[model samples]
Target: MSNSSLPEERELLRQIARGDESAYTLVFNHYSKQVFNAAMLYLKNTTPAREVVQEVFLKIWLKREAMSDVEDLTGYLFILTRNHIYDSFKKQATQLKAVDNFVQLQPDAIEDTDYRLQERQYDHLLNRAVSSLPPERKKVYIARKEGLSNEEISHKMNISIHTVKKQMQLAVQTVRSFVKQQLHI
Candidate 1:
C-alpha cells in the first residue's frame, strides 16, 4: 500500500490477500525472526516470545484480506505483536488479582488453617529462593514483589526498564526452579 514497499513485497502481500499459501510462508519466513526478537526484548523469555510470534502470524493469516490495505506490513505486524503482549500482561494481572481475592476470602476453619500452613511453607521457600539471588536480581525481585511497576523499578534502581524486566524474569525463573526442587516437584 505504500510507495516505498518493494514491488516484490507488494506482490507478496497481494498474493497473501489472494490466499496464496506460498506467499504466506514467504512472509512468515521473512518476518518471524523480527517479530520474535521484538517480542523477546519485552518478554525476556523464549516461551512467551514464541507464543507472541505464533499469535501474530495467526492473526495475519486470519485477516489476510486486510494485508493488501496495510500501508506498512512490518509496522502492522509490530502493532499486532505489541497489542497481543499488552493483552497477555493484562490477563496476567487479572489472574493475579483473582488469586489475591481468593486468598483473602474467608473459608471454613479447618480449610483456613491448612491453607495458612501451606501458604507459610510456600512463602518460606520463596524467601529462601529470593535470598539466594544475586544482589541486583534480589533488589529487582523485591521491588517487583512490593508491587512496583517495571518503570518504577527502573527509576528506583537507576537502570533501564529492559534491564528491570530481564532481571525480574530471571529472578522469577530462578525462584520457581528453587521452589520446585525444594518441594521435589
Candidate 2:
C-alpha cells in the first residue's frame, strides 16, 4: 500500500513474468487471504470461497506477463475477484431458472399420462361391450362405426331404413350404459 514497497513489488512482478516460482509464491502468499475473505463475504460458503482464491491466483500466474504493466496490482486483483463473483451468481440464476421450468411442467406431464391411461381403459371397455352384442345388432353397429350413413347401411344390408335406425339406436344405448357403469360415471 505504501509507495516505499512499490519498487519491491514491481521487482517481484518482473521476476514472476520471467517464470520465477519463488516470486509467484510470494505473490500468492500476500494476496490469497484477502481474495478468499472477499469471496467468502459474497458467496457465503467456504468451498466456493476457497475455489475463488485458487482461481484468482491461477489467473495471476497465467497472466504474469501482463502483471508487469499493471500500475495498481491490488486494484486489478479486486476487479478480477468482482468479475468472478458476478459470473458465479449468473450461473446460479440460470440453473435455478431451468429447475423452475421443469417444476412448472410436472403437473401437465402427469395429467397427460393420466389421460392416456384413462383413454386406453375406455377403449377396452367399449370393445368388450360391442363384442357381447347380438349378431344383427353387432352388424348394424359395425357399419355405423365404419362411417356409413343410415341409408347406406340399409342399402348394404338389404334392410329397410326403419329397421336400420331401430338397430342403431339400441346398439348406441347399450354401449352408453356399459361405458357409464364400467367407468362409475
Candidate 3:
C-alpha cells in the first residue's frame, strides 16, 4: 500500500471506504469488466458473469476499510468471483442430481405409459408454477437460473440495478415457497 506501487488501487480503496461515489465508480469501471470477463470464461453466460462482478464489487465496497490490508486486490477479487461461481455450479449440479435420481428410481419396464404420463404431469405442473411468478420475478429467475448477473439483467431489461436485485430475491423466495408446497420438500 506504499505510494510507490499499487497507489491507484490503494487510493481507490481509501476513497471507497470514505463513501466516495466516484471512487466506487472508478474502481468498478476499471476492475469489474475484468472480473466479469474472467467469470464468463467459467460461466459461459453474460448474466452470471455480470452477477459475479457485481457481487465482487459489492463485497469490496462493503469491506473497503479492510481492502487496504488485502495483499493483492486483483487476486482477491479473482478468487472470490471464482469461488462464488463454483458454488453456484455446485448447487445447480445438486438440483440436477435430485431430478435425475427421481427419474432413475421410477420403474421403467414394469410400468409403461402410466409412469411417463405421470412424469409429464409433474413437469407440466412445475412449469405452470414457474409461469405463475410475477413478470419481473419470472424474468429475473430465468436470467439468474441461466447464470446471469444483476448488471446483465438490469442492462437487458433496462432497469435499475437495485430493482434487478429485488426481482432476483423475490424470484428465489417465490420459487422456494412454491417448491415447498408442491413437492412437500
Q: Point to the candidate with the largest lDDT.
A: 1
How well does candidate 1 match the true structure in TM-score terms?
A: 0.55
Candidate 2 Cα lDDT to native? 0.86
What TM-score, computed on C-alpha atoms, does each candidate reach? 0.55, 0.83, 0.50
Give RMSD to native, each candidate.
26.5, 2.8, 30.1
lDDT of each: 0.89, 0.86, 0.80
Candidate 2 collision pairs: none
lDDT of 3 at 25: 85
Across residues 1-185, which tens digit of lDDT does each residue of candidate 2 receive? 21223348888888888889999898788877778877877888999989998988898888888877877777777778888989988999999999999999999999999999989988899999998888889999999999999999999999999999999999999989888888788
Q: Report the C-alpha lDDT of model 3 over 39-107, residue by residue, as the tens digit.
A: 988989998888888888888888877766767777777788888888988999999999998888776
* Residues 80-154 of candidate 1: C-alpha lDDT, one tens digit per residue: 988999999999999999998777674666688999999999889889999999999999999998999999999
Greater lDDT among 1 and 2 belongs to 1
Off by over 4 Å in 2: 1-7
Misplaced by over 4 Å in model 3 are 1-7, 104-185
lDDT of 3: 0.80
- Order candidates by TM-score, high to low: 2, 1, 3
Relative to the unseen true structure, what is the C-alpha lDDT of residue 114 in candidate 1, on a scale of 0 to 100?
Answer: 99
Candidate 2 RMSD to the correct structure: 2.8
